[model samples]
Target: MTSSLSWRLAFCFTLWLSQPLSLQAQETLADWRDVPVAQLEQGAQNGVADAQYALGLRLEKGRGLLQNFALAATWFTRAADQGHAAAQHRLGQYYFDGIGVETNAQAALNWLRKAAQAGDATYLYDLARVLETQPEGKPLAADLYQQAADLGHQEAAVSLAVLYQNGTGVAQDFARALQLYEGPAAAGQARAQNNLGLLYVRGNGVQQDYVRAAALFQAAADQGLALAMGNLATMYENGFGVPLDEALAVELHQLAARKNSAKTGNLHPGWVFDTRLAPPDSSAEALERLRQGVTRGDPLAGFLLGWHHLQKTETSQEEFRQAARLLRSSAEAGYPPAMANLGLMYFEGRALPQDYVLGYMWLVLAASAGQPEAPELAVVLSARMTQSQLVEAQELAVIKGGDQLANR
Candidate 1:
């Protein structure tokens, strides 16, 4: 049976075992009662691999049984001894995760290597993950990763590609990384597709192909990969992959922005959105979306709404107030762009009282988050402030806390 089916059966067995003794015997125990625990124990004792694996799972998870990690390990050992691929994989995970036993990375590696050698793709990828983070001077890690990648493990391919690209455990080779990513990306791995798209856009490994890059981005975006969505939106807006279609570009950006908002909530960071596409047909619609995003605690939407207002011929005090609140919320949540915007507001005395110290601090935080312009802005702002104020701002900037940006 498939592992999933086995898990389902195990779950059903657990539910059945929870009833009164008579009900358990009649409704559940009757079918399997003939297969006594003693019989299972005997079978496992006699080197029956399937019985050993089943009993191991039962003991490990306490399904229709008492949780006994020691028994689980013993059963796993028996099954693994009989060369059961799935059992070997489970044993590896148990060792690696230290579930029911002391953590043993080397033991995990050995079991996973056995499974990988048996053509288990999942085990191959798992093995690669372990090797990738091994301490420096371990020469075999990259080779093992490459072996797994050669076996058609998509994640392994990606990991190998990254190692090649960054010269981690391998010599730098952008061309090799690009080559490795192409097969998996073409086979519909979203991560591979996104990374390949980025490489294409940046012309790192191949000639820049905006059209191909957009197509790859679109494939990943269709799978709800937000980074791909944002990249594809940019291509549409800039007429890179397809003809410049402003309306379509805005639609894609809106979709990406909405997904970004939902996924990250108040932790939204300012990303490069291609607005070169057609302007919003209805500012009211944009405003509504922004308001919805803000209600959902999406800082990017709030910042965008603020920018929308500032670009208009007429500015409203209400807009500034809303922008200030949202920006402050985002800044507090560790979004550098929001912090930068808040700094600007303070510097100009537009929304709140002039507070150069606060402005400098926020700008410094923004700079720390990789905003290139923030440091320069901070410097200019600090020029008009006292030395003590600048020192305080510097201190505040270094106070690291929560996640400051969404994981890419």
Candidate 2:
């Protein structure tokens, strides 16, 4: 959403990822068109995967070479054989889409899995996309999607949430689906906000709060999500949240119809618990559910799970690190309790190094977001801080809060 490109679902391993423009990157492939074909061929045959991939890309796109899928596939395979992740991913796409290679599902799966496991988030999402096309691959696709989402792939999270909502691969757990949707939706994901609103109307997971649902629907609707517009209209017509206004409701529905076709580890500070999340029935259940939540990028669950681990004597050092990581993740997701805890932890050096300015800033964020103890704690901590440190922390907190609020 921050860029001009948008990903559209497709059978190919790639889903139209437009590369970011960068000054340095503009000098690489873009300037290498004049490289001699003989030199490129020599490098490719000698097993230089980058050359092979670049040559193949050029061939496939007819940039520096003739447009030849067969030649491109050959070059891609040569690079892929040497464990080039990008080449493997592209070869997998070629196989799936039958651009050059035969339509070999098995081959595509093999290549995609290799790329997904070895490559970054984009590869993971691409592999999941291909897997979703198979007849019995929904579960695997869903799992891969969760993995991608865990790594901050927003599209994958939305896709995985859809699977949970439909009970296609994973079990039909509305609570799970809601947990998956909340982070992305609050972050201004239009489809996520729309779908999450639908759940609220049905009372599937959290308590049915029409006011909350309408607010979410309105948010999504404002972003040009057709279904959200229709949903908001219904809420208006029924007086679910806002005052009943038939004319406004009709206008929204009409508008919707017009576009209906489109689609930290450590220990530390502040508090032990805030009682927003119910304590798990058992530690094991708690661990499992919280993990599931973490996989879905649910910050609340991540913080709760981290807190859970922090309380256990049996937790290992690696587990403590894991707890710290999850807590940091939740804090980044803008959970006030997490920010508060991280602040205190950084200040107190709980299983991590001391960072007073960071601690003060996080506490400031928590206070700004209405955490009960954060104001008092920030005031207390500010006294020990220098004027410059306080100013810097204030600036940092302001920027972070602005970004978080834009999504929330």
**lDDT, residue 47, model 1:** 81
Find the candidate with the highest TM-score and give its number: 2
Off by over 4 Å in 2: 1-47, 59-74, 100-102, 233-408
Q: For model 1, how does the per-residue alpha-carbon lDDT over 1-408 read when each residue is reduced to its tens digit?
A: 111100000000111112122221133223333476778778778887777876776554334443345568778888888787766767877777565557798998888788667665556666666665567622466677677677666777877787787787788898998998889998999878888887888788799888888899899999987667777777776777688776876788788777755442222233222243343334678779978987898866766665665555666877777667877887777666677888877776767887877776677667656555665465444446654565555555445322343322
Per-residue CA lDDT of model 2 for 1-408, tens digit only, reads: 012212121112222212331222233345344678788778777777777877887665444333355678898899889887777878988787666567788899899888776647767877788878889999998988888899887778887888888788889888888888888997889888888877777777788888988999899889987667877888878888788888998999788766642221122233546667676545576679878999999998888888877677687777667777887899888887888888877777666677878887787777666577775566455545654565567667767777887977
Each model's lDDT: 0.65, 0.72
What lDDT, from 0 to 1, does candidate 1 have?
Answer: 0.65
lDDT of 2 at 386: 55
Candidate 1 lowest-lDDT run of ten: 5-14
Clashes of each: 1, 7
Residue 47, candidate 2: C-alpha displacement in angstroms: 4.3
| TM-score for all models, in order of appearance | 0.46, 0.50
